[model samples]
Target: MFTEKGTLPDGIEYDGTLHSGYEIREQLVGDAISVFDDADVTARAVKNPQYLSVCVLANMLVSLGSIPKDKITGDLLMSMSQDNFNELRAAEERLDAKRKSFRAENKK
Candidate 1:
């Protein structure tokens, strides 16, 4: 299901399976400002705000269908800066554009 070409950062390991779309429907469909606002609050309330933020971002990324859940780990995620996440989102957008183009061409 994951056809992307990037690898996890070194020294990170994750053995989780890809999450189904159903698992993160709330994140996907919920209002972006609200979800993140909630995450921000939750992070501020917790002793480990940074860790919580990473989890929140990872879940959001998964919900967006940008990356498979299995491919993500806390360590791998921590290594990624916000710019890296943005890059990942951009890559997903490009892939989606290609898929749409291919589908439209073939449908005719």
Candidate 2:
């Protein structure tokens, strides 16, 4: 995993890691979605698509200050300050873009 360090609004340093698109898909489908019933998941997806981003962030975030990776959950992310949450979302986007660029340059 490739990790980049960033600072939160509160100045807490964290590491965000890049994940492959297939790994993200597996996280969403094989873990996040599979944990819930299909109908329930579908309703939640329709009502709160933003949660999918939370899941992806939780999956990619490697560390936050002293916080353990396993302790980083969607609820924990949601509980963060809006500025912090937005920073994290932006970090995820940056990491995703980097991963895509790397894949594009490496493709045979």
Candidate 3:
């Protein structure tokens, strides 16, 4: 189950079919690597939860082995409500704060 909001919901039927989170994640990883040409950039991008999220959803439609005749676009994500986007930004900020504090303490 997704711990965060704004992800495609699980446990509900889509076109009379459903997929497990494990399968979805596996596909997400595969699709992500294929989408990005540079492995290093893809690796770094995946580390950011927000960016990874975008990858997750972007892959969802095609993850189950369906080919996309049209290019998979991020227009849907870009149209997300401001509140949800803000929440994502806030979460990243919290993670950044924790990382900064941890670094400062370890440098002593």
Candidate 4:
């Protein structure tokens, strides 16, 4: 399972057990707004069949290609809460602020 806070670039390394040459992926990710928008447009086209008549299938940029009508159930994802993201950002800020000191100071 992935962590809610593991939404950083380079956060994922290789999954040693699963595959060979570094099976890395973004641990957690943001919503695909474009995908959502395309799905919506396709949904509308589907509802009003007359609309498709105008385009004559000229534009699939919205869908990026053919969309599987049956597979789309309109399920979307949750965005990170401002409070939680801010907290993580603050923690990162604090760590960065102390980075120079941490690196320069001699460990006794």
Best by TM-score: 2
Across residues 10-84, which tens digit of lDDT does each residue of candidate 1 receive?
Answer: 223234333222122123334233334555545543767566545554554443223445555444566555655
In the order shown, the candidates' Cα RMSDs to the true structure are 8.5, 7.4, 10.1, 16.4
Candidate order, TM-score descending: 2, 1, 3, 4
Q: How many residue pairs clash per model?
A: 0, 0, 0, 0
Candidate 3 structure quality by residue, lDDT tens digits, 4-39: 223333332233454222122123356555546656
Model 4 C-alpha lDDT versus the unseen true structure: 0.31
10 residues in a row with least lDDT, candidate 3: 19-28
Relative to the unseen true structure, what is the C-alpha lDDT of residue 42 in candidate 1, on a scale of 0 to 100?
56
Worst 10 residues of 2 by lDDT: 18-27
Against the true structure, whose lDDT is highest? 2
Error of 2 at 5 (Å): 1.9
lDDT of prediction 1: 0.45
Model 3 CA lDDT for position 13: 28
Off by over 4 Å in 2: 11-47
**Candidate 4, run of 10 with poorest lDDT:** 18-27
Summarize candidate 4's per-residue lDDT along 1-108 as a digit string, tens digits.
Answer: 211122322221222221111111111222222332576656765776544322221121122112332322222001223443344344444545566466678556
